[model samples]
Target: MRANSAAAVLLLLACSAAATAEAGGGPAVAAMFVFGDSLVDAGNNNGLVTLAKADYSPYGVDFPSGATGRFCNGGTVADHLGELLGLPLIPPYNGRFSVGSSPFCGVNYASAGSGILGDSGKLFGALFPMERQIQNFQRTVEEMRARMGESTEEFLSRSLFLICAGSNDYINNYLLPLSDKPKAYSGAAYAKLLVRRFGIQLESLYWSGGRRFLIAGLGPLGCMPSQIGAGNSSGCVDATNRLAQLFNANLRSILRRLNDSLRDARFLYWDTYSTSSDVINNFSLYGFRYPHLACCGVGRERGKFACPPLLPLECGNRSEFIFWDPFHPTDAFNAIAARRAFDGRLQRRSPMNVRELVQLPLRHQ
Candidate 1:
């Protein structure tokens, strides 16, 4: 069967989940600690002198603030996920409010070009690598301890820790020009390297009192508009996609091992690739009139660069496109993907969904 046909058949075989309501009067978890790349970034790079930012108009035109540093045209996956969990949209760690003043829902530490390795996204100029992001989280924990006093660990144990990095490691670092990583390590070898580093980061979060982890696997980076625009192939670049798969597979194995070792911890793997690929493959099913073309952006695939403050080429119906820019999905797509990862019973979220993870009993480490 053809690829689209195969996707349609799988769709029919898939199980659909109902909307999950928040637990009782408020969010099930005490808070949501987010860390990652642009996927979950919520204005963390707003004022930073970095080339990896999206704090301009047309980016958040559909959003209330007009432009809020989210790569998408409106709310992000983190925002939707938080809403479903009965928490207010988590603010960026670098936002106006300092540590203790942040809302109980938690703070977003994700930056647009961040990756698992400290060296990743260096070309972005001043981007927050994962190590630094983790450091920021450590500081946040300290602040929480100072504010919450003796109840800090107890409260944090009941919170959800969400991470969605790795894409930029491949897109911005490994595959970029003049990079020595690809030469030094094979794709599979590099994947193992990333897994090792990512494992360490999770261990750090665990040490800092995080027990519930919603770890999002990398999506099909080769299929993204940026890659498509740069490639000679008419279809999704298979090489890049293969690299992503290798990393994701290794990541799942690492998470399983961590879960086996950590008695009180619950590490839930969120399959970003499957849900996202399915939507991209069957655009009509998701109400996307154009899956390949971005809603905003200019140049090739509307993905050559970030959508500028004034891009006259932006699509009229932002909701009808799968992507807001060449690299990031539209807000509508983010919401759909977020919901699927949150409560869907399908393979998109394995072992248990984010809802199930949140509902798990909090236990001291």
Candidate 2:
């Protein structure tokens, strides 16, 4: 099918599912727990002393909340998925809502500039690594245990765990000039190391009560505007793209292993790489005019730096652009990817799509 036609069909299905969920029927899963880096961060960086914050004008101009610290112009992929699942916006872990409330829907633990490795984005300062995010979720689980008692496990088993990370491990650490990671490990070795640690992180969450998992593979990092600008090249940086491919391949193997070994748990992988590549390669088909340039930055490809605060250089036709800033996607692109992740075929989402994963019957524990 044509890319645009497929996107339209997905959009219709998403709207129909949303309507079904809203017509007095509850969301598909109990809740959605988000983890990972900036790609899906809802606003955790706002409370942190990090350079990766987006709580200002033009950042969330297209979003309903208007600059709630999302890296995108509108909603993140996680936000769109939540809406499609008939759930309200998943609150960030740092937000006030996470403290007093039971978060029946779920909380987002993703932080901008964080990665599987603790020191991956230390250059940015004060963001939650995957380990810390899991620790925070563990605390939330404990709180839920206090409130729901014996039912906590069942509630968690029914919840969806959405993890979208690992990009920073490459962009902010391994690939960076000053970082020692490149010197310590080869590209293949680095990818293996990341997947190994990620497996450990997933196991931690599993022990903490998570059952259903939706882990997003890294997108085409080398094709981001920032990479293009950094390389001063007309196209994507091939070496960086190769690194992402390696990591994604390792991640797929790890997830299959996890699903095979972990009883009652299902770990599904979402191919962000293929989805983003499709949008980039077929930009016109997806109605995107500028797939390589950011909608909100300055410099070559408008990606030399993060989108500045209180600036008017941002693109007026945001929907026509793919990248929102140097490293993130515009809301339009995010919606496409989210829809694909939710209901795309097995080629895009291995094992099963999120819609199917959410509907899987929970075996009696």
Candidate 3:
């Protein structure tokens, strides 16, 4: 049953890709470089010795290739965005596609459990922090320079840098009972720290010739199944949501500052919190029957642990669920979010959306 559903979705995606290509004529941007955590991770964690991994079954039941290490059941938000941009799926930095040659369409440096802060996901073991991911991108730049020479600069400048991070910093670090972060800093202070660190990371990318950035703000972390389960709350936890809101506010201010100060750089922000809240609040309108429960997992709301390798039980209709596991959204939801981020209005994607961002004239340096 799941296989049939996956095949149907695959066919639909192929048709959509073909139609999108025919309409756009070609790829919208030179490439799309992705950075962030599990939400956009395209199997980077599969090579790492980490507890935070989703390389097994029931994980990618909806994807044609099956569990390729993406957290969703099928295509991730990044994968969908790549298709919408008329580009092929962006390969993970640690994967075989990135090993022998430079992917001109860009590479994904995101890893599961990674965060803005270096020590945010220390408990997960062997994950790439934002700084390390930037270092990896630097390596890619050097590779591109060797192959394309000075042309690499223009190539990257015209490309899009899509980033979606910061959830783990709060969920796995500051809010964890065993973590020391909560002890040392208040919620507001921690958010400020994250924003400052995030700014430095973006600057590092800018220095590396990246000019177009679409940074996704943290979603309502308090509304995730894990948070609800942890707090034993029937509804979203207000305190956790407040912390996320604080970080998002700071994130927007920093991006605006960067856009104003940096030359030839356009730092567009995506309001994931508000967008996600709307979807959850009006799940029926979006075809979601289980907005707050996991499609696959065990325990209360099936949000206690990550989906196990051997399926104890799984939802028959994955497309109807917003969440695939305890911590990640389903492929259906990923597609919706990607579409919104690609062409949403000012309220969702500030200043401009990805479509507009790609259309902006590149100022040669």
Candidate 4:
């Protein structure tokens, strides 16, 4: 999309969302910039050619307005992140919505099944690389500026950058071994690759004027519904979870080093692994009826498909449910996750918390 056209569209969407939030007696989110996979995907893949697309049935069934391409029934972590930041949830940078019904705070550039690398095979004959997502973010900002003018600064600076990705590289790409090594990079190699690629891609944002960032680490890829279903048809695979730990560990180190190297970069880590694990570890505590079993979808594990597609029972209340589908979290899960992430509990990992990381005022680019 042309930069101006994209901006105009965002301006309209933002205004619409703002109107709705005001009516609801809720405060509008300052602004938002998102990058990730299905976990935070609002609707980027809807336009792109990919089986990972969620525009179809049951994906947005739980959304406030119903069926918004959020991958799950309702909202996503990105939307909840905006709420935590004291703003309204945003939608896809590409998805269309009415003025009165939009992710008001900002737009989502996340794509389902997209990875940190374009190596997730061709989506619609084209790859949705992290670089492309970042570029889209820049375009989003440009669109906002055209509409709000000076208000754009506050929205951009105060806005949060929700970046979630890496699972695809491990799950869809290289986690599996083969004769020709077909599909994806090796697990260990993909970790380093993600770190490096993440650094480069995020640097583009930093230099382009983004300051505060909320980057999510890789979740338990092996433990995902698809992975666990690989052969076991059960929830929570030990080896896959271990690989998650490896990725998370490397991610922890990378975040620290990136902060050190960037000096002024005020970035925060959204440890989806821990946050995700917290749910699995304490499902009963969270009011989950089935922690190991997916609330929606088909098969024991490997046969799992979209939730709405299945004729199985639906949880009475999703807020207390754990896994929404085979590979994603439910809307209620995101609501709580936003609370945890904003409360500073979920993002608390090794070296220091996100608050401590962004402590140094960004003085230089």
User: In candidate 3, residue 351 scores what lDDT?
Assistant: 42
What lDDT does candidate 2 reach at residue 305? 88
**Which runs of model 2 end up more than 4 angstroms from their true locations?**
1-28, 98-104, 347-351, 363-365
For model 4, how big is the CA root-mean-square deviation? 4.8
* Residue pairs with clashing backbones, model 2: none
Which tens-of-lDDT digit does each residue in 292-317 have in candidate 2? 98998888898898788857855888
Model 4 spans with C-alpha error above 4 angstroms: 3-5, 8-29, 101-104, 121-127, 142-155, 176-186, 233-235, 301-303, 308-320, 346-365
TM-score of each: 0.89, 0.90, 0.90, 0.82
By how many angstroms RMSD does model 1 differ from the true structure?
A: 10.2
TM for candidate 1 is 0.89
Q: Better model by lDDT, 1 or 3?
A: 3
**Tens-digit per-residue lDDT, 175-251, candidate 3:** 88888888899988998999999999999999999999999998888878887877667889999999999999999
| Per-residue lDDT value at 94 in model 4 | 68
RMSD of each: 10.2, 8.1, 6.9, 4.8
* Candidate with the larger lDDT of 3 and 4: 3
Give the candidates in order of lDDT, highest first.
2, 3, 1, 4
